[model samples]
Target: MGSIDPPPIKLPSIKLDTTLAELYKRASPKTAGLRLGLASCGVTSAVDLTPDFQRNSRYPYQDQALIKVPRRQLTLDNTNLRKSIAKKYLSLIPQRDAFIAGAMPVILFNLGQSPKQIEHDRREAETTISVLDCAQRPDLIFCPGPIKIPLQPEQDHGHGIDKLDYKVVLDGLEANQDRLTRDLETHWFLNSKAALARSGLPTPRSEILETEGVPPEDPESCCRVCAAAASSSSSPGSAAELPLFPAKCTGPRGRWLAAQKDRILSAARARPVPFVFKTQQAFGGAGTWLVRTAEQKSALLAELAGDDSDNDDDDGVLGKLLAQVTSSNAHLGPATVLLSELVGADGDGKTVVGDYGLTFVVTDRDDEADGGAAHFLAASEQNTDGSNAWIGSTISYPRQEQLRRKFEGLMRQTAAWLARYGYIGPVGVDVLEVKKSGSGQGETEFFIVDLNARISGSMSLPLLRGHFVGRGLTCASSVSIVAKGGRAGFIQRWRKPFEEGRMLILSWYEDPEAGESIAEVVIGGENEERLQELVQRVRENIEEVTL
Candidate 1:
């Protein structure tokens, strides 16, 4: 929130390619093209493109194909899926398509259920990605946001839509759509949170409270209506009413919150252990803190009540934090505080992190799940530190059956919840398994961490291998190739194991400068030793080849 300069405006540069020229010749010289924003955060771009293509069966148009032009550079450590996408584009899209000049075919298909009708009335077609030339106005341009800059006035030389005729799609529509989507997701999370509580799952106890004016000073005044409704539902569970977690909705006010924080701090200190505090609106562990001592809690409250001089810009965020804390019994502390119960480590002295679990997705074709092939992608995983652990390094594959069983149940529930909320894309539910405290029996306790609502890291694993398991591809044979190389020199490495039909090579690269390259090779074969060997060889090769 500090004083920072606004980013400079950028102008678009058209890169004319041969394929685009050919596309211009084939389509009516007067025909217009449609360009959809396929950026990562955009709606249409979130759908899994490969399955969409297989399901739809028809390439919409030979000359007009969907493309994903990333606004970034590619690195040597690209994933196998990305490499495959690049190769596919190089082979499919011709070099002479006129209307599609400079566009990269990162994806060949556009998949998303469209509204019943699209209006084509506007004279100036608008998009987030600027189309430099003003003469060729597309009949309909679909982008995720509103246009910020005006197009240059010019006349078309008989190439497309009449000069000075284009339409603009406002950003308000897309923004509203995204907001609705987030609301729906929040509702789903709420329902799932209730289900976990009812099913005797281990989750942090919480409640929802709605209030008028600023939040009340007394926590007892907060309503428990949402919790009551959830508990009374006719789901399969014990008939006894369960204790509801506190959830509160409130307006903006500093005085009410200052009083409430004092009471919450006293109540929290009365307990044996310190409590964890979080802001309602914050995501990804932001605005969360652990309060362990009265001194620290008092300091936090002082900061909240202190005058705003240097941190005036953070006042809005601080206001939201105060509202959330006072609404319920949650407190606010220093960002560096850590007061949660310490979960024990594994036998090997390593803290056991949660499984980076992902949902196995099998899309329904004709409303039936039978014919659709399942593809697995890794989703976000919850680590011991309450942060998201992605695919490559943070988490290792869960090798124990006990851990896997607990994770599988969590995943099943997660997938069901996602399906209910109209999300057909690849999803994942990350959960952690820690040893139960004071049990002495070494029983593992499971906790639900976070939900990933999109295609995750594991999605590419299965695809890289010939067989798609809906989570990851098995590359046992490919792993063997690396394993064999470990016994020999790095220069004599064999690529044949990865070439095996069963193995999936996630990535492969050879750098000239450092002479070092890395690849994510998955082992799919049944042989454990062979897989181990392949992993060793790959590791060794990476070390030797890299400068």
Candidate 2:
């Protein structure tokens, strides 16, 4: 089996003026200054930095500046100018210690380079930062998103900056974005038909097309169907059918309506027994269902019909399904409907293995963020195809030694690949872990599944924590998700259990101090007994925490 390495250990140094120095002198010696990227994307995405600043603002030194560089204009000249302006702003802020660059991917991608070219630009960009001042260099440089590179030691050795020290914030579900995208390119699955060809992985067979009229209802109506089905089945095809994974129909509503329905029905019938039905555009598990029998399918159809009545819609079941497929419309484009085969559990009760979502951050620094350091945040776990059950999660602050090595290796591989495409910054990779059947221990396998090209919720926690701490920080605790809404009431009702650690729930939305909106439950400390107590409390009051 291939081995995964942990990240390296390195921390950015914060420069402090008299006031900040005095403050640090009085506090823990381990405390370090942290610069936050308070850009709009960072703030709305909940990249936490407020707490950290609050805790450290009183330090002997502090620097503040709003660095605004256009996303579309990341030329070397613009980058240098931004850096110069940032330096000037720092000069004015009192007791400033260190610098943290916090530009996001939205801005980065707008630079208009492919994934591959982005790497060369990034290296050049980092070089610019390095040469700015020999006397006082920025201690840490963090991206608002995950770095789209694998972690590799040999390859990273000569870089002027410590790659490990640079951090990419990520959401929990999308940690492996970089790896998946790399795999996609490596495997050549960028478009729909290409994705279908690579079906050995967990992706659905699908297709993509541009049409002026509505989609065709007959299977043979479109050429994509002929191509997709031609390989697997000998059956004669129809014009409306297309062979693809997550098949998409794009055009005016009327032209595609009938064809889209036929495609959805065909997908439903063709799916294996005990499958799931999901609308393409839904998020956070919405518009997803498990269908074991025709009865359940009918029930779902009835529900869709009911929904249609409220809006005076004519499409009924098909329409609801189509709406779900197009929910991510703004981002994906207009009038597009996607239908994918549902992947489910195997007979052994293990969900069909889909892919693992590995969330990690890449920092410009060559070292890992300190233990319990909240400077970088990420969420990731293995996603199975069948049950959709997640296994092997690493949500809390990473053990620097354990995480860095793995991240570095992965980043090195990913970066090298992306360097060819002009894509840089934070990425989320969806991976599939396939295990051999029988022997109760067949060799386990890993494959890339999908990719998310932005900052994720997994990274938000650490950011928030760091903002609270006002230093480069990481958390040694795990944050558990609970139902949204009424979280405050739930926490208030179960405060005792939480304090006692009987319920080791970390409220993601709860202001640790104010205790509002307990979106997540947190559990910490080295005490096993305390952990257990929290677990029991969670078991007892789960209903309160869940919607």
Candidate 3:
């Protein structure tokens, strides 16, 4: 959080674009029906969630572990071990299911896990949901977890570990596809539509897949399928004319890494040193590196070049890079990196990053256009600790509607672009408005840095706001804190604040047998300042009580 001066210029209010209102109308729950939710953190975020790579590193799960257990007992207790193995992976069940209301019940699904593991994770997720008073919020059931079918010895490859998991889930889905489609809307939502498509499910829209340079459709096989379909006149559009995909509009990647690297070098020569390097494979800033000098960039590149030679299971930036390569294609040189003009401080400037995201649902598909359309659901302001680790999020109307309009336009363009590939589901876009030169007086610039085509940490803030505000609250924000030792019960000490409408424990899960707990609080206040003040008060109270 750097300090920034107020707007250097008077910003004009953006005239409301009918796109949002139209989208809202189209997505009314009356139009949207009950759809099954495929709730898994890793696979949805494009990260491979397997025991080999380990549980999801995203929050709710990232901090979940058995803190005080004896090492020897950990190996003996299969139940506790399964819970520990799948703790973080199960966090999304409640998080995603919270968005569903009405009679629409979701059948939660997960891959690379057993039925016992899924049940354990579901129980853990339900504990937090109960704390949030969301136990009865949505009608939900846990689908039997996917069975792991190991790859044969001859065909075993590093990639088969993930591929096999998808196969098991997809096979189960196909076996019961008739029953599922009959009983539920069966909307397949996960991180990678390409992966989903690989499971024999339909592919969804995703620019990440596009910029990764995966051809929109498999020219050899998929085109043949489309061609045969066209011969039968089964679907719309011609085989010769594929939809014109919009060029990569935002994020760090364009074309191949080789070309992207050349652009980075060019940008470095023109601007300042110490640029930002982000790996295409990382989620939650794990694959991000700060290249401080030419020497550092050279060293980092040298390390990346040796990625193929390294067998070390490191989870740092390099480890994440290698993991992404092994999970993706082998021909991609074992790693890919994106270099961008560092969005850090600008020449002795002091600035605070105004991080924001828009969550929307794709509503319509236009075969003529290269992409599809989406309806805006909510807006969220991300609160980071300045290290890219998300602290929490403030959900409110933007002070500058103009900036929001720009964000909406970008999202619409992105959604339409993704729609080209038949993707329709919840989509989140990450945008940043930086104070030019990192100073209050510096010129301001906003860049769309990342595109999360799946559910994200801040995605649920808007939903929480809708849920709470509808219950007669002024505003709402989601705050998370690690509950260490006595602080897991710190909520009892903050009873006065909860009674005063300063804070509400939306979801609190403290393992009865573990030392570390996670408390996800939905704090309410009359205004943004009051909400922030209440959050601070809660933190101060926790410190005193824990001490």
* TM-score for each of the candidates: 0.39, 0.42, 0.56
1 or 3, which is superior by TM-score?
A: 3
Better of 1 and 2 by lDDT: 2
The positional error of residue 502 in candidate 2, measured at the CA in angstroms, is: 12
Give the alpha carbon lDDT tens digit for every residue of 193-229 in model 2: 2232233433443333222233333334445533444
- Over 1-547, each residue of candidate 3 has an lDDT whose tens digit, in order, gives 9998533222111111222212323543343333332323322222223333322222111111111122122222235544433333444323433333222333344323667566655664454444333333444445433222122344323222211101101222333444332211122222222322233221211222222333233212434443343354324322211111112212122123334334433443443455665544333434445667777666555444333233322112332333222222333332344444445535434254676766777655433232336656666776655345455567764333454455656667666665655545566666666666635565655555555554555555554444445435565676666566533245456656554544554433445457765555667666777777877876664421100
Which ranges in model 1 have alpha carbons more than 4 Å from their true place? 1-39, 42-201, 206-274, 290-318, 322-406, 418-423, 437-442, 455-547
Which of the two, 1 or 3, has more lDDT?
3
Task: Quantify all predictions' global Cα lDDT against the true fold.
Answer: 0.31, 0.32, 0.41
Tell me the alpha-carbon RMSD of every candidate.
Answer: 19.6, 18.9, 16.4
What candidate 2 gets wrong by more than 4 Å, as runs, is 1-256, 274-278, 287-344, 347-356, 362-421, 430-432, 437-441, 447-450, 460-518, 525-532, 535-547
What's each prediction's clash count? 53, 142, 13
Model 1 agreement with the true structure over 359-459: per-residue lDDT tens digits? 45523222222222222333323222332112132222333234344455555555455445444434445555665555567776566543445333333
How well does candidate 2 match the true structure in TM-score terms?
Answer: 0.42
Q: For this target, which candidate reaches the highest lDDT against the unseen true structure?
A: 3
